[model samples]
Target: MIFAYNKAHVGDVLMILVKNDNGADVTSTRCGNVTKIALKETNEVVAWNIFQASEMLGEISGVGQVVLSDEQIALLNEELAKEGFREVITQEKNSKFVIGFVKELTPHPDSDHLNIAQVEVDNGEMLQIVAGAPNIEQGQLVVVAKVGAMMPNGLVIWDGELRGVKSSGMMCSPRELQLENAPDVRGILVLEEGSATIGEAFSPEKHWHG
Candidate 1:
């Protein structure tokens, strides 16, 4: 999740995007302090905007470095109160990223160095993706930039076609994924299995998979 606010530009609400891509046509439901955003057809809770973030008790996991503004937290609380959800915001934050396991790898049909990979994000879901990095290996713990993720390069993850094949998110390389000081090389990043938990914020456990 990302938070942005402009104090000097205008007195507007801070924006937190649960889903990276929100279409223009959105349906909103206000339940006390929580506001639910959904598509008309699916009614899936694609995004949530709470009036107060602190008033929450126990849903969040992990320890994120984020410090939500009082206004933003209050907004989330207000929305939550409206929703009638139990007042439960957890002190822990969920993982937004997880180490993906590459189950299969294939050469990209249209690209010289790119390869198509079927990566499992520990969520039990497999995604077909294209990557240019070379050292990607099957059964390895690779970093997964799942769908709806926003790259440090400002690239938005979404469904798209690559060389006649439909690609879902991306398998990250330290450089292409835009991590700090990622090696500027031609290999994909392989996460040490012990480095990351199975799920939480960036992890599939915390993120919506279905």
Candidate 2:
């Protein structure tokens, strides 16, 4: 469940998302006044009071209209973590992607163009990733979308297999990272030597911040 501010409310108000469990709104009991919102072909309920009428998105767990502070969001994540539900942050304050060093590279057995790379991300762990770009080479510094990262274009990184190789994450290109002034070139984006640390977050927004 996630919390958000209801835009319709003129005053401060907080809304909590209660995921649909077993095709029923799980949090309807907490919100006394039940507002049953149709989730397309699903039986889910958005139980709340004084919310502006709107459509329901089936994929999202829940979004409340109540805005929360950074401290409040942290507290909520901690509380929710105790319940075995993944922590959900309502705001995007930090970049989930990071810079990485390509520690090793090897040719894929089945594909001549595909390469299996060992990339060391921050946290002292090496991630096995399958890369196809011809420019990628060992010892190069590149951007890595760590598992669970959400790319700017809405692609979520997850564990998967490419051909026959098990890949834990992705080596990103400039367009994939959605950087401003991104070069119109092919292959992955390679950072300059000493430009960034192996595990530093890729935060292009920092360049524009005072």
Candidate 3:
């Protein structure tokens, strides 16, 4: 759910939309098979509902299921936070992805570019992961795919080794997660600075085509 201000238009009123008829007066854009909830007074849209699998049009932001562990919901009210607003959503109780912090990074003994990293998936556990991304570094917040996670490309993550270095999980890429405007390069996806909480889930809406 979104708690954003009307970015398209400055308005003092709030528009509540639950059904199609409730938003009849506004111009709804087509996003996949779903309808975007744009405001009548302006182009401000805070959310959408996915109905089918299809390519999206224009620059519509996607929404995913998320649960806030703290009362930092006020961060969503910040002006800068509105631009390309995204969330690390967890779709279910047993989520497959989670926020992780890179605790340490050491060179792989057998590989030139590979690094053996100690990542903190939660407060107590430290996962030893072998990552090949050049951008993987210490003190960065990232999404970690646990074993059994079914990636968007249908690759199920499993505990494995890189150059004989055992890796418990994997750091994710935006392309693997199917996020919009994901960088078409070889690098692990890093969350925005200070945007993620340790151990928070990272399961975005799979049906989002935006």
Candidate 4:
């Protein structure tokens, strides 16, 4: 497995999908059967596109189960190899998140339930992020968004999605990703594990353990 950045354009999420093509009737279908996933990079495969694979092939045969296809795997490898990225064999990236620390968290002057925080991400890059969580506090090791982050729920973190407002990225909590044990509330989360130093990484790997 790989930690592909989840992207949505039109209507799809991208991942460094690992599947075996057990040779089914990948052919014989017209369109929308197989989907096209572009392996892209901005230094790495930072963004990708998804579409019906059948459409990309435009009348072909011998396409089989993407999860069990040697040919498909080879094709994917070939693409990445061309770009110098090795094949990923573990699911670590899938369940982990690298985050920055929040040096300061201040209440938003505009709203009561809202708060503005000064977060230090990437060791040096600091940002003023507006948050709305009760438990959030100063000097807390919180999750930092390094620009391009996609919530598991398919909400793109680009400029805020609030009322006529723009947000840079998100300071994620467990529930946003729908962790099984995530507290049911709208609030920021404090990491109990991992270092939240700027540019560092953390993940909800523990969330699925129980």
Candidate of highest TM-score: 2
Write model 1 residue lDDT over 1-210, tens digit each, in one string. Answer: 544333334223334455533464678877655567667776655566544443453233222224454554555655566567544232223333456777898888788877888887766778888877768777777767666565665565667777788888777666665555656677766756566554323532322222
Local distance difference test, per candidate?
0.59, 0.63, 0.60, 0.49
In order of appearance, the predictions have TM-scores of 0.55, 0.60, 0.53, 0.52
lDDT ranking from best candidate downward: 2, 3, 1, 4
Total backbone clashes of candidate 4, pairs 3 or more residues apart or in separate chains: 17
Please give, for residues 74-110, the per-residue lDDT of candidate 2 as tens digits. 6545544554444243554445478899999999999
TM-score of the candidate numbered 2?
0.60
lDDT, candidate 4, equals 0.49
Highest lDDT model number: 2
- The alpha-carbon RMSD values of the candidates against the true structure, listed in the order shown, are 7.8, 8.8, 16.0, 11.2
**Candidate 3 lDDT (Cα, whole model)?**
0.60
Indicate the residue-level lDDT of 142 in model 2: 87
Off by over 4 Å in 3: 1-92, 203-210
| Higher-lDDT candidate of 1 and 4 | 1
